[model samples]
Target: MRTGKPSKTAIKVSSSIVTLGTTSYGQQILPDGLVDASEKILLASGVVSEKGVRWIKSPRMVSVYRAFDWLLPGQFEALGERKAFFERQVRAGIAAGATQILVLGAGFDTLGWRLATEFPKVKFFEIDHPVTANVKAKAVSKLGRRGNLYLIAEELGKRKLPDVLATHGSWNRESRSVILAEGLLMYLPAQAVRELFGQCLAIAGAESRVVFSYIPAGPDGRLDAGRWTGLMLWLQKVAGEPWLWSIEPQNIRSFLEGIGWKIAPELEGGTGRHSTEYFAVATNQA
Candidate 1:
């Protein structure tokens, strides 16, 4: 992300969602409705021709992506699992009496769209960089707008979250909400991360919760994953969005408490031999 350019990683994630939704492995991990919504967005974005959409479903392209997975190792599975995991958290929040869904750095994810349709009474708001948000806005417009779903375009790290969200008339700060920051925190600096959480808390009503993902530091307090660490960092740097922040798994509790949140009981694994990523659920009891 340059100031005006769309996030390359966002486009890549959209493409991966389509591939996974179309493939068997993805079918296993993702909800049927979510895959369907993603497929609709893929076509609506006009990134590919209607004929090219058919081509995307071809076994050849899927195999090509599978080969890339071999190079990246567990990335494909991780993405699918991550999406499914987030959906479960969102559903849990809704069931727990949340009336609002606020997604930060929403990228091209179809979670909000699909959930908006599923839970018509609950409002859904997705905020992203103007460039990427515009792309999604165009696609979403073609899908027929849901009155409850608000697509907001703002530069998250540059602007204060509270100010950006406050400008949106449809956003209800007094409502109980589930704030999602999937694949976003690592791209921000440590201070920005703190401010984001603080602002989310400020805007949310009591008991509002957050679900976010991050790449945790290894035991040595570095974002090292053996042979893949350098390559991963290089790939993100090449895309102009390098990973800049990470928290040790053990320290996550204190970190969130410092920001007016309490970590959920189930703390996902940190950077270890088994996994490099971590997902967290924290509640804003205040």
Candidate 2:
């Protein structure tokens, strides 16, 4: 489990890698090339010899990754759906004249690398913990600096993101940017989630947009996400990261509106109906 410092949080990192692996190798979520490159890089990392990256793309790991789906079927299906939502947001950002692209909690994903090439003028920020950022930097270094990828290494719990950006980021509060927080919000408490939105508002212009995925939890704060099963307990024990906050899809509008964002859209899987998990793209209206 390649994870966090002073404790074992790398397992969560590997969990993200597993998602990339299964999707990269199995579902062909991305028909184009390089979709699986990051997973390939992780497999070739030093941790493979140290057994840091495992249970992904292999039968056993794929089975465990799929087990949560059995309890709440089509959750895996939803992950596939999320890939499209992210791309749409990025395209919209580029069309909207975004100066920078911020990928918050960017694990081992390669979206930044691809986006940098596709949009040469836009600077891409891949923000993550120092450990994950370090490993990703090394592996990506072998690929030879794709474009203007600025790596900002910092732990979110240790500091507010805008402050970290002030120290390490090239863009600023006035910069028109698009933010992606895929698979990140669920780990934060509601207060922290509120703080995240507040920070987004502080930095964003009226045109700034954010796209993210969330797990809808019941009133007790347990995962009843969109009529899906709640396997959060198993995740807390296995991955060491638990689902902490949730909101119903319909309420997402009010939630963002209360925070000064205009509702963009909530997209679903190719199946039409939203999967167990859903994605929302909200723009800063103020």
Clash pairs for candidate 2: 2-10, 3-9, 3-10, 4-9, 4-10
Query: How many residue pairs collide in each prediction?
Result: 0, 5
Model 1 clashing-pair count: 0
What are the runs in model 1 whose C-alpha is more than 4 Å off?
49-52, 266-275
**Candidate 2, residue 213: lDDT:** 80
**Model 2 Cα lDDT, one tens digit per residue, 1-286:** 2255311333334344455545544355542443355455565444443254444545676667567565656655455456656776787788878888888877766778777887889888988778777777777787768658887777776788778878865767787889888877877779888888878877766688888888765666456754424454555547656667778766778988888877775322332234545677778855
lDDT of each: 0.80, 0.67
Q: Which is the leading candidate under TM-score?
A: 1
Superposed model 2: Cα runs more than 4 Å off: 1-28, 47-68, 219-221, 225-231, 266-274
